[model samples]
Target: MPEPAGAEDWMPRRLAARRAVITGAGAGIGRAIARRFAAEGARVLVADIDSGEAESVARELGPPALAHAVDVSREESVAAMIGRAVDEWQGLDVLVNNAGIGIAANTPDTGIEDWRRVLDVCLTGTFFGMKHAIPLLRAGGGGAIINMSSVAAIVGVADRAAYCAAKGGILALTRAAAVDHAGEGIRVNCIAPGTVDTPWIERITRGYDDPAAARAAMEARQPHGRLVSPEEIAAMAAYLASDEAASVIGAAMVVDGGMTAR
Candidate 1:
């Protein structure tokens, strides 16, 4: 008879045994992913523009987590972040491209600078992260990449022309990467979330004339009558990173509380 699998032989076990680098991990969905991956036994490199917050999260995750201050929009910064991960972890296996910004201005009123800034962080940042990450992933023999897109990529929202364009660009980028690297044992996918109740969303609502009303309207817009949680998005990221999701490539998973159902 065939021998039974050892305690550690199970697939998808010890997810944290691999090494991962996540951008924007100082807060929101990125922070949640960092926590989850650390819990799963993966050594995590938490990279964010906010150095203090990144260090705090890394400390909270204890020994296996490393923190770095990274501006993903810049090629050199992104290259350094990826290089640090390889140096610290010996190699990199997973990458979560979660750094992004939101801009709330109509196309006509959106200043050239604002549009450029939003695109630089949201779209160009993702591109740079992917560019730097692929070599490491290839060196490691293969890996999974999760790009954080948004429901905005699928549907129109007012006063967010730049944000929408950047997210839409991410979806296309995700698809292209998946195809380009499939032969190299790399899997690429995107997650498009709805109105998630992160600090960013809170800030957006707080600026409204009726903050409470605006918050309620945001909730009401979701078919679930609530905003998506950072943890929920992190859960999806974990699944995608696991071997169980080996065939889930070039796909855009929507975690939007059925917002796109209509």
Candidate 2:
């Protein structure tokens, strides 16, 4: 069985006293990151398009966490979300641009709308987050930004053309931002996750003729023979958000069960 979530040892409080905003914190990887950050002593703004989910996650994290409704694809919404964090904490230490969606279709079968939607959320959303958050980070005397990419960005996955393209864009963006801001003490990095066992994966498999078989196939393709857990990705985010990663900039940290190794 996969090991349970969280640090194996005592919590290191790596992010102690940090102020953070995580997009899409209503569920899955975002939620996990919020929880982990709270455990590490950071106050978090749990922002999500789903107000209720965001509220629930914020409440779960208690007084240190605030829930904010946000649609990352919209510039105004992204701006407001970051503004709230700044108002609440006076500045920001970390921003996790984790909101994203995937459309399962090859380029030929992909509709224009679907392509635009995927890019809007996955790629443009990251762009918006960085655009709005960078100045605040600069004002705060430097901070960290963790953008969520995917193995799809590093290796081609059949029928995920839009996802691949958007995630690929994230890596390039991370590199540019890292270079642009590194001298200012602002570090930018991305996490390239493998197929994580999240509700999103379940939703994706439902479209398959045999959801079980499809999930199994996904697992088999991973060298580790299991789906990556959301918590694992969260752990990486925590590390990147910490001062320990002071020298780690423009890096794409892969946590994919060795999916790209094959």
Candidate 3:
């Protein structure tokens, strides 16, 4: 059995004794969530499509931490991921569907294949995680599910037609899952972040004519005039995973620096 969180964990050890699996944990927000969950005393499984990166993160987190290569878009891969957790930890608890990508394309530029790819990974991938995880969670006496959404899910962003559509779909999926599973002690929620400072954003900005100006423009979207951090999102995930958020059901916790307030 995994050891209960010590007093030295982040956020006062909110997620003690929990076992969590975070997808796309190779880098960015997924990586932050894995680390944060570990710090809070949970044994984390760093799941990513990239085996090397996932193993690296697992090694970084040390004992009780394991790495697995999983392609969220594939149902078999997702099933294997959940199975590994239950097999290794003897049960399951929390799951973070954080693997996603963005394609710079408007409705016009969004080809059929492009749309399918975005939806497959961002939307269907979340579905696979939830579908396979729910049973294990119920067996383990219920747990929390936090899906990673975006500001685009709530509002709109130009040239992100496919991405926005997929994110928006996640909101609907989250709510439905929460309502269906609440009676079983499962709490489903999502974090809709805006302009988070992660490797993804850095890559997007680097493609711009002036990376600095691109960053400034991205930051300007949020009221705080800066991008949110991966650590910040992880903090909220910790709270959601804990019993403290027992009442927070089907809620889309917007940690977008008040970007949607405008």
Question: Distance from true position, residue 89, model 1, in Å?
Answer: 1.2
Lowest lDDT 10-residue stretch of candidate 3: 1-10
- lDDT of residue 246 for candidate 1: 94
Candidate-wise lDDT, in order = 0.89, 0.93, 0.92
- Candidate 3 clash pair list: none
Model 1: lDDT to the true structure: 0.89
Off by over 4 Å in 3: 1-10
In the range 1-262, model 3's lDDT, one tens digit per residue, is 5443222422577777788999999999999999889888888999999999999998888888899999999999999999999789988899999999889999988899989989999999999999999998888789999999988999989999999999999999999999999999999999999888999999999999999999999899889999999989988998999999999999999999998999
Q: What C-alpha root-mean-square deviation, in Å, does candidate 3 show against the real structure?
A: 2.1
Q: Which digits, one per residue and each the tens of the lDDT, describe model 2 over residues 152-191? A: 8899999999999999999999999999999988999999
> Order of all candidates by lDDT, from best down to worst?
2, 3, 1
RMSD per candidate (Å) reads 4.8, 3.5, 2.1
Per residue, candidate 1 scores C-alpha lDDT tens digits across 1-262 of 2221111233244474788999999999999988878776778899999999999999988877889999998999999999898788788899999999987899999999999999999999999989988987887789999999999999998889999999999999999999999889999999999999899998999999999999999999899999999988988998998887899999999999999888
